[model samples]
Target: MMYPPPESQSLKTLLPETPILLMGSGPVPVPQEVATASSIVISHLGETMKKIVARVQLMAQYVFQTKTTKIFGISGPSSAGMEMAIGSLLWPGRKVLVLNLGTFSARFAEMARGVGAEVKEILPQGLAPIYIEQVREAFEKDSFDVLTIVQGETSCGVKNIHLKEIVELAKSHGVLTIVDAVCTLSTMPLPMDEWGIDIVFVGGQKGLSAVPGISLIAISENTFQFISNRTQAMPHWCLDPRRAFKFWGLGEYHYTAPVTGILALHEGLRLICEEGLEARFERHLKCSSALQNSLEAMGFSLFTPAEFRLNSVVAINNLSNVNTKELISLLIKECHVEISGAFGLDIIRVGQMGEQSRFENIERVIRALAFGYGKFGHKLDLESGLKVLNISRDSGKK
Candidate 1:
């Protein structure tokens, strides 16, 4: 008989008086299944922990759609996974080519440079998409061993749709590919094996809707062999993928694993499987589209262009008349909604990911935003935004 998950109070139950709407980049509301898993008590070095580790490994395989690649669950957030990928693949004398689309890609390049690797960046101007011709030109001018990129840059709400082409280009030139899919793992279409990505990592909290602290890294066989054959020792133990796989995969017990985090991720992936990958992707897209249409109707312009915009996160420009900080404070204080702050320019980021990606949630955010704008003496066209939402709903029905 299969045992059921433990019962626990949810975030809503704990905070009954104040209900918060989380539309930030990560740590979204968790589903009941994930919360239940997190509430369970399991030993760090026991049969239950072993089963949990195996379940997570299997879930990673399913989520990434890979059969032969090695998967490891690091006991940290997605940044740890990024470090592991870089440390495993890049060393001294190695050259890395990074496509700097946003803050995350810039971080990847910084990490590469910190590791004594020669780094060249293809920084796109503003929020524009990096064209293939630019990448071709860069590749022709410089010879690099690894190409690092982010599939979806959460900071600027940009998705590189031409990731497969970029990876194929790198592979053709004998260059390894490293992808950071922290924001687009389950919400977008990413076939690691089919697209020929060498190393990729994702966060458990962002798209998977699990608690933060688990980073799943999937390594291709060729990349695994390359890391295994490296003569130089990795600077840190956590940055070594072989050590992570040995401890997490083989149950050798490197350090204390995050049992609750692993179990929560397992349940989160199970829920994703139940929802069906294509269905989840469609839900995210529809919700994002509705949010964008509503925001545009309310006289707010999106930061990223339509072609390069991400379905998981939407960034909007701040009104010239209203103070951004004051607007954000009013939204949280009065409307009980929480969103991310501004980045380079005055832009607000809203995430529609995992359990938060629903029609009711999207509508709630729009209404709160409209109400907040009203408090600042600026009247927004809420009716027009609602009409757009209704139209989107009707179109979906048809």
Candidate 2:
């Protein structure tokens, strides 16, 4: 039988509209001026807008250090970035080795196989991550043309330590390393060229705090030459990076890059530079730590192990006598705070990304959540948790 919505409308009515806190998906608050700048770029670059494309590619280098790259504005959401990367690189007869620790990794494995590449998955169940030892063993067992891994597993709130080492491993084996930093880039430290990452893809919607439409793919000089040497046909028209590179190099749109999204992404990257990546990383780490400390004191167990936990995000277990789905709805409908459901079951994640990583916002989320949980019939030790949240928030302010 389908479960009924918990908590009466009576409870929801007493709460505020549009939850005062947002701890869900990235796309954190954008500065008024930055938001306006993106809109202005879109309107001003009407019709002949290759300049927008050039600006995006150049700005990406400034922010991400993804030198000599191609930007594609294919028809798909953030997830499409992976498909574009995989479909473009993997040939029909190629073999792919994927080190998957979460849902996105699984999707990558599936997509690679669908493209007719032989795929193998190395995933760790429960709350742990795939360590470097496991990856080394996998590499020894099988040879692969390309090695792919997600930088941050958004599904489980874990960051695999194997990202840098694994990429280096691929380099040693004469295999290409493709990193899915769709959720990690800008939020954390990912130096593409320095780290020898051949192909790196990230979405604008996450830590960049821009609307979802654009995906940034970086191609290294070595990988560019490697792909060009391949005899396989480009699987898709819009995703072909060779075509994109020519257009970007000549400052023209081979296939129109997302004009408006390019604008939004430019502003977003601008803001990141303004804030400084090192400072931003510290803020995200601080915010996630504060949230985790507060939740743990309130008796919420973390689904991911403490050491390997992602600094930009955290996943918490469902409290006793609480339905995760119903609790999430109440958080939105009543408290006006939004969080995401767990990767597997009864879990809720708190995201600290971009402007949402601010101390004030984190405090509001902790306070409102403390109050909100009471309405759900869970006796969350409100005073203790809020006290911890405030302490960390104040510490961060200083």
Candidate 3:
């Protein structure tokens, strides 16, 4: 007899009865279309599954504006996407240059080292964007087989806007380029084919507004040939990109695919297409900008520079008068709102990814922050925050 799927409560379900706003780094609230798709029943390895996979791949192509690049779906989070991209290209004798900006970029370096590839990191100073001049200097000094960079550094809420130029520079040096677009995919400007990116990976949950457990990877023909030429076996069978391509490209199944996650991603991509990429990006920008303006008006400073701030996540420096940890706890306990604390900085992050990138949603978060700060012996200017929201709405932003 077949057993039913195991029953468990998700984090969202475990929260209190109050309506909680998820303005944190990842796993943003899914859109209604995605939630509906998640409830659909489907087999994991059948014709229906094949159709869903193809649809997801096509949607990825449309979202990334790629024509001929091969796309693959992995049955894991964006971390698995990173490993797949790195493990597919890295070998014992290869040199990998990693542009280190925040925690995730460091993880890329670690993955390269794990594969026994000689890794060199070009680290920026204090959460700043990795400059093209720095990358040029690194390239002048040494030769590299592959160069990896994160398009959006979620840990610090910074977006490296010089990616297209960087890709061209890497091409000039005959170095393969890889990008981690986990937080920027579908929410920012990332044209894989136009930029000539060799390999890039994005999370299904962050900007796609789908449920977690899926990673999408796009590969160019040149990168595919490099993987095809590898003679030695991969250290992990699950991380083999060629095998994954066969599984996604052909009907051969390597492992059980997450049917519900794929369905959610399909619906999320459908919504994105319906909304239009430019419109969706504008929505994120307006909402994030308004939130930042309100926060600044309330005497909180932004963590990232104005020129390099990401449109999806906002990092605010903690106030000296109020205990941040206590304020965060009180917000969750009393207001039922959740924001994220930075890994090694005195900052809190608010995300405006996908469906949560709305004026009212951001206004709610501001109100929650005001309430939490007030309860913690700090009087924030709630009227000023609300006024910003009103002006943003009246100005037809978002």
Candidate 4:
């Protein structure tokens, strides 16, 4: 039977045989250590699981660069992490100010509205990062119980470079801050504790380089106390921080945990620790900077401005001469590399997180893109692009 067999075939179709380079928004290639750990099945309530969780929590602290110990993993993608934060802090009659910069930030607004919170969103009118002035303008308009922002807006590669200041501004107004660190968490320096963010959530598949289904959240002590003191009961039982803390914080069982997923995440975090955050951040910067330089030399324009560009997932304008959908398909079919298209914008995203941050991997994807552009009758300066990548790599050795 053919792999991913036709819908007419049985449900137990074989997995695809060839490995395609995942250079899209997320679910990037997992490191060898993470892959090995995921293959082993263990009891969730066993002593072994406890040992792994213990180490993972410490390693996660280093990755987040946060002093908070109220960290735990939820059993889904990053969205699950988002839901947990919302359910724990937001309630009926509460007011939330959402900084709606792009697709991902807009989701926070929708989730806040779902929680029965009075949601007011500031939809910035450009592809640039939300300025401190914009945030200040919103603050002058009204007060909010909670302020939601995406540190790195993945949909457009826009990084809120003013996040630390914005959160400070909200804090001064007695507003709790929840940052969606999904695309930026491990790829860049977040410094959650220093930034005084109440809650920061991330997915395992992105910067963590683990498989999806296991997500993590970092909660400040103040945030935990706020959740505990709230009169309104948490709407979500499974995502409730009170119950989740009992399991991951207090070493008591709240529910059957995703053992395999935790193991994978633990290994992923271990890799981050082994590499050291400073080294990891530098590596990501070099690779991403090289990628941007090469793309520009190849005649592609970056959608996000250089000053506020996100290094994790890059957004580039679609070549006017090439059909983006067809180019993406050709890259997958002929070059075995996968990228992502925007929701409503004429741009394509290339992910540069975890294993994808390596120079060799970046080179591979650049070559694949050049090949695709060539097939579409637009011959990019491939040699110049490669030279730029080489120069960046060489400069990093200094």
Give the number of the best model, judged by TM-score: 4
Which segments of model 2 are wrong by more than 4 Å? 1-21, 41-52, 71-75, 396-398
Note each model's CA RMSD in angstroms. 5.9, 6.0, 3.1, 3.1
Candidate 3 contains a number of clashing pairs equal to 0
Q: Tens digits of per-residue lDDT for model 4 on 1-398?
A: 76785557553464445678999998999988899999998888757777888898999988888888899999888999999998888888899999998889998888888889999988776777778898899889888899999989989898998999999999999999999999777888899988888999999999899988999999998889889898897889899988998889777898998888999999999888898888888888889999999999988899988889999999999887777899999998898899998888899999999999988888989999999989988889989999999998888465
lDDT tens readout by residue for model 2, 1-398:
99988866686787674535557756556656557755753433344456666666677775566676555444456667788779877978898988887788888898898889999888775567777787788889988888888888887888887678888878898888888887777878999888888888887777887667677788787777877787788887777777766565565546655666667777888778788888878877887788888888886788878878886667777677777777778777766777788766677777877767877777667766676677777777767777887888678353
Runs in model 1 lying further than 4 Å from the true structure: 1-17
In model 3, which residue pairs have backbone atoms overlapping below 3 Å?
none
Give me the candidate number with maximum lDDT: 4
The sequence of per-residue lDDT tens digits that candidate 3 reaches over residues 345-370 is: 88889998997788877887898898
Root mean square deviation (Cα) for candidate 4: 3.1
Q: How are the candidates ranked when ordered by TM-score, highest leading?
A: 4, 3, 1, 2
TM-score of each: 0.93, 0.89, 0.94, 0.95
Candidate 1 lDDT over 126-229, as tens digits, reads: 67757677789998998999999899888888888788898999999999999999989988899899999998899888899998888889999888888889
- Which has the better TM-score: candidate 1, or candidate 3? 3
lDDT of 4 at 302: 91
The whole-model C-alpha lDDT of candidate 3 against the native structure comes to 0.86
Ranking of all candidate structures by their lDDT, best first: 4, 3, 1, 2
Please say which candidate is ahead in lDDT: 1 or 2: 1
Please list the residue runs of candidate 4 whose C-alpha ends up more than 4 Å from where it truly belongs after superposition.
1-13
What are the clashing pairs of model 1? none
